[model samples]
Target: MKVPARQALQMYCAHLREQAAGRASNGELDLVNERAGLAKAQRERIEMQNAVTRGELAPVTLIEEVLSKAGGKIAGILEGIPGAVKRRVPALSGDEIKNIGAEIARVRNIVASMSLADLRDSGAESDEDRGAGSDEVIDA
Candidate 1:
């Protein structure tokens, strides 16, 4: 229809002719495919960069760090509760506290093992996006 499209059609037709004559193999076609894939990948990277700049997306590590900090705060609160458990309930003694601690640890492990699949599925909202283009890796 357009000049560039017409030229590309002509070139493809020439390649097809060469193939029909057994003068050219699919190697050229494969190269073209690879180049198209590379171009697509590069375009995606640019679009992702732009999204980050606009605060529409954030880095994985940043999200991990935020989650880690929240987890740490929760752990601190949980740890404090064990000591208070004895004072709050006077009749609770001996291995009771220890058992409670063990159960808490077990529950924590189960919760920690829970899949984060739901988080990955959800769309990142506009207002909450932060830490654009930051590649900071969380050690957790």
Candidate 2:
């Protein structure tokens, strides 16, 4: 890799000779690399400590728990849509509300059932839209 640059330098000195440019032993190079790695790790540790002191970083478990709770709240709100519809639209009959609930459940299941693993294992499944003989009703 250094050959091109070294060749270009020959134009400046005709009598110049090349010598061993590497360490006497692999152990010497390894020691230098180890010290460089130690310095990098120390810097990383200091950065993490500084972030924690500034309250910019949180534990992974705490973050996961907060996100999970928020997702649960959203799911609960989505599950209540049918009841809200029934309350607001009193003209809709019981069967119509049941059908709405069934449609909501189908959508919820479609969202909840999808995963990276499921996609990798069997690809994506096609879903039929509402009023396609889907009679299962889920009570919120």
Candidate 3:
């Protein structure tokens, strides 16, 4: 069984103390302390090795983590957008309001007609074009 690093270091120090007290032969005590020190080093190396083997250790990259956290935060803000716009923005002219509503409905209809698989496979240009600046209607 493998010993933990701290315990191995403690054992090594204890053996040194035994040698100092003349309770063990110098050669045997030194060998025991050396093995204990090696065990401590090996234990730490194995921990790092196991972490890499299990894919729990990853390269230090903040981009993915930052984007993941920010994406959810932005999505939450967008979810309350209708209320925010109503309260904060000046009222639009009736025709402008109607145009906005129609645009939203048109985008919704396009999204509702698309297959889940197609949407999942679609890239940014395809996604933006699907719901905006296009008159192509999906044939349901």
Candidate 4:
């Protein structure tokens, strides 16, 4: 039977407490406390997995916000280039300016095609790969 996350955790904690209290010899409570913590962690992990599967949880895109702010800064830099040319900066060649414009267009095309969900999925894959690496290190 499927029980709610909070209820399942609460029931497990109560059961653990009761069992521990019954078996305690005045100072053997640490082991029971550790068991309860482990159980709580497992329950919370399952709840998080369920919530993710049900689409009840979503990642907040602070990275997307930062990218937007960086885009604005890039635009300002691009705009300032024309002023630099006006001031006759010998370092700024026409071909170099054209290359910069082309690169910015390429970046825009790439960013426009990628949605937040796509980014999140890729991020999840990266996280999994990182976790797998850690597991390998531990096994070694």
Candidate 5:
């Protein structure tokens, strides 16, 4: 059976509310807001998945748009780090350069994993659409 978009949204909202309540109980306002933001993003993702399922949008289009925004963010992070490193040191030693390079590679790997997860989620949603029809939603 396919779940309606409204039901999915309600469930997601309820889940968010529960998380927020738990955080509040723990007296963690910062954590609550951070979790709320993540919940909001998840909600948006659900909507995007629905749009893809309904043939209202293409998955590739959404993926490319998201990746472009993520690329900009990654670029900004990369740009800012070099200036910070330079400000903290007169000049970087070869070893320091190598260490920084390794750190960058590690961060790049994390970014790549995140991107891959997004792609995998989109593909899974596409498969769900094929198997169960437009309203059939799965949490990716």
Candidate 6:
């Protein structure tokens, strides 16, 4: 049975949403795994310090190895989904791409100027921080 084009597109979008949900779940799992690994590494470091006090293997190399392996696993888990979604979106025209690039740069500059104090403050900076300068238009 042939589905209508709109229905097919709706099904495709639903599938993408499911995939995105899965990716989000995977991301959360990765974060939890990272946190567990971090706690484990901290514990190992403490233990290594104790071992050093008691005269053990030169220094603690195991913590570094654990951290590296955890980092690699987390990075691999996070990298797969964005590319799949990007493949589904249409490419922007040259002018549109340039506008996006400019807006991104402008936002980056604004973010760069923000200090930790500014971030923590209830009402930080003024209209100035809210893209007061630069004429980078962002079209949705």
On lDDT, the candidate that comes out on top is 1
lDDT of each: 0.74, 0.73, 0.67, 0.68, 0.70, 0.64
Off by over 4 Å in 6: 1-91, 131-140
Candidate 3 structure lDDT: 0.67
Give per-model TM-scores: 0.52, 0.53, 0.29, 0.29, 0.33, 0.28
In the range 9-72, model 1's lDDT, one tens digit per residue, is: 9999998887776556475565555667899999999999999999999889998899899988
Give a tens-digit lDDT track for model 6, residues 95-117: 65555555555555565465658
RMSD of 6: 29.1
Better of 3 and 6 by lDDT: 3
Q: Which stretch of 10 consecutive residues in model 6 shows the poorest summed lDDT?
A: 77-86
TM-score of 1: 0.52
Question: Which of the two, 2 or 3, has more TM-score?
Answer: 2
lDDT, model 4, position 127: 47
lDDT of 1: 0.74
Off by over 4 Å in 3: 1-86, 124-140
Q: Give the alpha carbon lDDT tens digit for every residue of 38-70 in model 5.
A: 999999999999987998987677878998898
Give the poorly placed runs of model 1, Cα more than 4 Å off: 1-31, 111-140
What is the alpha-carbon lDDT of model 5 when measured against the actual structure? 0.70
Candidate 3: Cα lDDT at 78: 48
Q: Which ten residues in a row have the lowest lDDT in candidate 5?
A: 127-136
Name the candidate, 4 or 5, with the larger lDDT value: 5
Clashing pairs in 4: none
